[model samples]
Target chain A: MFRPCGLFDETYAKNIAIVRTRQHWILIIIGLFIFLTFPLYLSGRILHFINLLGITLIAVQGLNILTGFTGQISLGQSAFVCVGAYTSALLTVHLNFSFFLALPCAAIITAVIGTIFGAPAMRIKGFYLAMATLAAQFLIPWMVTNVRTDLTGGSQAMHVPAPSIGGFVFNDQQSIFYIIIPITCLSIFLIRNLTRSRVGLAFLAIRDNDLAAETMGINLTKYKLLAFFICSFYAGVAGSLWAHWMRAISPDQFNLMESVWYLGMIIVGGMGSVIGVVYGVLFIKVFDISIILIGPRLTSFLPPQLAQDTAAGLAPFTFGMIILVFLIFEPRGLAHRWEIIKGYFRLWPFKY
Target chain B: MLLFVQFLINGILVGGIYALIALSIVLIYKSTRVFNFAIGEMMAIGAFILYTFLATVKFSLWIALPMTVISTLIIGFFIERLALRPLIGQPILIAIMATIALSLIFKGIVFFAWGSPIICYPERILPGEATMVGKLFLSNELICTFLITISVFISMSLFFRFIKTGLFMRATAEGHDLAQASGINVERIFAVSWAIAAMIAAFGGIMLGIRFGIGIGTLPLVAIKAFPAVLFGGLESVLGAVIGGLIVGILESFVGGYIDPKFSEITPYIILLLILLFRPEGLFGLKRIERI
Candidate 1:
């Protein structure tokens, strides 16, 4: 909220505007332009990465609202995403529903499932709640794999048809980028606005102290479950995008480790901040891609027996090390650092 | 009736190891208030270290077992000092995430050292013969495991009841500031708890290795299976952890035998969800009263 010394808002509209300064508007416009036109200039590999990044960003943003904002730690987020993916995949494959129709249906179903799992949150809290959600992580996948093996393809990969809009097929990464990036932008916009609303304030209240929030007459049950609903909705959207993007789906795609990685992303980014979600997802995704790129080269320097293990192990090792470093040294995360840097710029040439 | 008894006995034996692993988790949680998510990896690494000594270096069991315990204790101590100590006053989420990170780091280390192979101990740690109780056959390895687990329970109980260090740990668990005020080194207690927890995890891992052969894939899953037991017994209750482990193990055995083999995998988590809904405090855990 810090601004340059000479910029004062004379009107309420100008004061409340998210894009307050001319520089902010210009930066937003230019950033959107570059992001929208990326496929035109960037290589296929980078575009593919961006598409995946965009989808992951949506999922992490939802996580920020739940864990970061509402103070409920869900260890089963990827499981919720799995529900969305499988639901969307099944709707298209069996029921012959349009991609457009299936996406929302998938998201809604996932939200319902998430809410059901979150019902236990009403009774338990902290580590116990985490364990309850952890049950969802295991049980959902088990159901997907074993309960209806015939329908779900039973631990085997179920092929998802490429999404099409009246003969314009989104068969490749570049085409899917069109679907992923815009939705990512819209999701960012909605979540940002949502966090600034009355509901968002209620979420913040509960997160800070649920018991206190209840004393303040903030309806705890409604908001907590609502947060879970919205969180899973975002995951459902992301999962649907993922299934369509990959052209195949499996229970393995959304495992417990992926759930942990999502939590790690939000933590690294800074919980309770939307821009932080962007920073966190981008940081981790880039780190992951770079590791994959560098892994073979780094492994070649080691002895052959050690090489294979190093190649496989380095990514997780470094990832864990980074999370540990962040938790220890920068627990407030990169967003807090960004705030400090912004403050420095705003108060330029002044010690205060 | 005979078949049911056989499954029940088998369940109790396997449950003994589950209880041991759950105890490791409960120990760290009680002392430091940090849920050690890396418990599975701790168990895996301990088993691997034992495997290296017994199989790779061909050290005698006498030397290898003690060495494994010492190395794991050091690992646990350094983990607390380097990773967790800095985040002491931070939020609970940060502490939990730290353990998750530790789990990943430990997992990566296990992968780096052992790769993916299922390695067996060079010699059998227990007798292989199954003793027949009428028509029900009980394996010697399992009976020994149950006896060892019971002895461990006894020793741990006695240690907590009688020993000075154990008393300090109890005091620290009750309240950090209060313990420090009473001349107890709270920091040392945290390190000691972690060390002991790691050693216990190693014991569970070694016991499991004796039964199934140590594999990176399966050992961690076993720890996860123990989670329900931890929850069922109550997070803070050693008795609860033991009883919970036995119940979950028996439940899994029955489910596997009667219902389906696959259902057994998720039975613990199902119980976890059920416990959270009906009795979040667990059967033996103390019910905390929150005040504003």
Candidate 2:
């Protein structure tokens, strides 16, 4: 059991030499990041960005489960998140329910919808699965706007009031920040521990090879649906928080673009790593927010008309370009890059 | 009955436009097995080019149309080389995301280059509606639509049938490895496929602009509509593309004419979802499981 403690066989010995770092170093890096981020939260310019980062981190966690764990590709994760957002918003605002009451129900409702939509999973995988999700992307938004127009507020956007607890209102952006950050941290910890457990192992097993896993007596349907449920449940939680944080719910927020951003977070963050989700969200979302702020500054040298034209367009273009550049050259992402820097220190003076 | 015929005429005209649009998607997938999600945006870019060239540069249609086609072809070829070629042996999902990213980038770039406002394509053809076969009403726009559709169809059919360049493209599309083994330049052929797809998209966009005038704000939705057309016809077959386009166009027309005004607009996509549930392969599409 302690063989990976630099006392292992040939393969692990070589790997550990490369990857294993003193635990204190990672702690320091994380600690430093938190310290830097703490000051940003104090500033007004970044409160909204930080809150968005928190919600995105949660959404990426859900995606990490589907893509990073179960090997499913979904472009409709935003739709599931929308499901949770609308459900929770509806419950809290119209039904006069509390966040605590609405949150679980929201997650449950999203899970149920995810599993049902995921029923097509038995027959489809890869690009076919992608197409199916694309269908869901079109379907849910259409349903919310067209069929359940009144309830979903159609395209007019719905107001989700600030969450209240007992007698206290978690009203402002700062208060919502407190709620989101802790939930994000808790989810990260829970997913990390959960993946180490039997359920997580099963998901990984299924991801690696469904046939092999099934022959080992893992029920493919049960486990696959469970993954859909769990993954989507996480999306629900993220959505509920976002609905409250933004104090609004519009189909625009859950458009296909957001889904692609979430996928970018997973791929560019480092697939199959919990730290990847957080890093991906923070790195991408922060860069995105920074671009919105700094894009015009860079383009200020350009003609005034040109600068105005480039402002709205440059952010999405830069994001897509970054994703392309990173995917082509740095598929392992920032988490893996950070791992490498730590490795150089851990292996100092050992020339191996 | 006159209303039905009028809607049918409009449907077929628009359907022909959609057929050209879906052909871009089908052609790319045929050779490379990569679904080019950026086709609609490519169409939008073409429309933007033509829109700007005529309105801003005051270029002739003959010059502007070819210019748009050539530029878009270059863009598509570069995208394949820059975004997709590196991901050659990577999973299909990477390619899908790459193309999706390309689509987003295209949307962003176009949204930037051409402001997001809706720019109508100025009417160039003479204004005259004609009564054909006693009850059938035809216009210069409809005639142009028919002519463009037929010419595109004939040229493509001949290109694949008789042209050596077309043969190489078809071979590359059919299977890259086999084409490579047969001494064909497979990578070059893939680039050619993208160029050809872009050309078709450009043609479609120009035609649509000429027919309905380009609506800049709603260009993204054009590709979104084309998806269901591809869904109806099966993603891989050329004939299926035409058939699917016509069916969706006609069905949508009938629904818009007879059904509730709101629901009519959604009829095509709703039908597409229903068709997908029962026949995932689509009409005239070969049944394919996930893996070979």
Candidate 3:
């Protein structure tokens, strides 16, 4: 609907399509082709890194819906992931369900649990809601580790079987990438459409002003809980995918730090937009992975004791600095920057 | 019964330390309307500073104690001036995220300085002997810490009630714009509140370090534990934080002693969730009303 320059939409379907122009379609195809063929030329480590990005993007996408779209901050995202991971793992290992069958089931169960936790959002907002949701961060892990040691494997990690689709086993890194890529693309496409739908408008309304939304006859309780459910469902799918890919699950994998990282991703990428999720996850994850990779090499030149300290502190210190800088100077995030660049190109040959 | 009493006593003693930290959090939230997530790091840094001064620099307790408090107060003031001051009029979410970043930075700094090893405070700073009183044994350090905590509380309560500066802080807490209109110099009050909070956190940190030794990861855990207390007592009420801290401490102790040790870890959070469900504003907190 929003046409710039000489761009025009001739049909209703064309106007609503995500890839608006022919140029957009061509770029998307080229991007997908590059990603699809990367395994041929890239190392297993790089593939593994993309695999992590894919999984985290899925979860961050969920967080974008809750915190970004709906304006409800949840520090309990890791807990929701834990539920999904454990549920999928349990269904496969204990009940002998297939990975495909278990993944959606796990997501649904996590959604139910997420909805329960999100019930407080109707009455509380802002920091109070953040604190209340933190209960999930503390409680879910405790429950997994303590309540039923048998099903969850307690403090010990549970093993997952390699998922197979009609005799093709997704066991190797490349094979897992095949599974991850499709799911990741599907999630992005679906969420992109979701944010453009009526439900998304309601979520945006709630985020902007809950009281105003309520007065406008938007059922705060229903929509807020729905956002929680949908968001947690995304986390569930990510957790399920991760579990099957890693072939092992543990409470430690989905901890408070990971939840915070997911939040940082949305904050850094830009909130309220679908593509922002991608940019945020890619930026933070790449930064983080680079730190892990380069930290040791950078520290090797220092004295052994000091090196150890520096190596330990470098990642968090830099990550914190990035978050601080973004919040202070560029609170709009990477997605906003992307738009600015696009605008510059669109307005090229003419000074603003 | 005696065991229960022992746990109760231990809980109370530990609760005193939590009360100190919760009070600091409550102070900042009251005055600045910002829930500082960096508090645990503040405490950890304070403890580390005390360790550096006393163990590394060879300062005596009498000198090191005041030095640690003063330096930590300055650190707190800088955090407000640098990190939080720029965040005025921002959404609560952005401010909270900033504090989280500040916490990470503080944690990184401490890790860079001291690494991950647990650092023990010098034993000479506090009495180490255990004393018996009617079949119960109490650590002399715990007793000393408890006494200091009581004195701090009494002095703080008096300060808020009577002192001119404290009155300015209270006024500022009531409404920043109103206080500014009344010529209260709200920015100075904000800095002072943060300083006072930081000093209290430093005190708690020193005591806890003396009790359990200071570790990078465990120091921040204190802030997480203090959350339920701050919420339970009410974020805006100092007295509420004190009571909430004690309740949480004793609840954790009883649960750990009776039900399961693991339950103690989540007891505070569970209480927080329950409190939020039943009373979103908290016991002593003012009801927040949304305007259309």
- Model 2 C-alpha lDDT per residue in residues B110-202, reported as the tens digit of each score: 757876666677656334665476777676666676677678777888988899988898787667788999999888878888888888888
TM-score of chain A of 1: 0.97
lDDT of 3 by residue, A1-352 (tens): 2236677778999878887778989998999999899888899989988998999999999999999999999988989998998889999999999999999999999999999999988788889989987888989988999987977889898999989889988888888898899999999999989988999999999999999998999999999999999999998999899899888788888888888888888889987878888999999998998898899899999889889889889988888899888888888799888888888787787766
TM-score of 1: 0.98
Which candidate has the top score in lDDT? 1
Error of 2 at A348 (Å): 3.2
Looking at model 3, what is the TM-score of chain A?
0.96
TM-score of each: 0.98, 0.90, 0.97
Clash-forming residue pairs, model 1: B233-B240
Residue-pair clashes per candidate? 1, 1, 0
DockQ of each: 0.78, 0.51, 0.80
Model 3, span B162-249: residue lDDT tens: 9998898889888999999999999998899899889888888888887789987887887788898899998899888888888888
The lDDT of model 3 is: 0.88
Model 1 per-residue lDDT tens digits across residues A172-229? 8778899999999999999998998999999999989999999999999999999999
Model 1 residue B114 lDDT score: 89
| Model 2 agreement with the true structure over A30-73: per-residue lDDT tens digits | 98578446644487546767778878888889889888888888
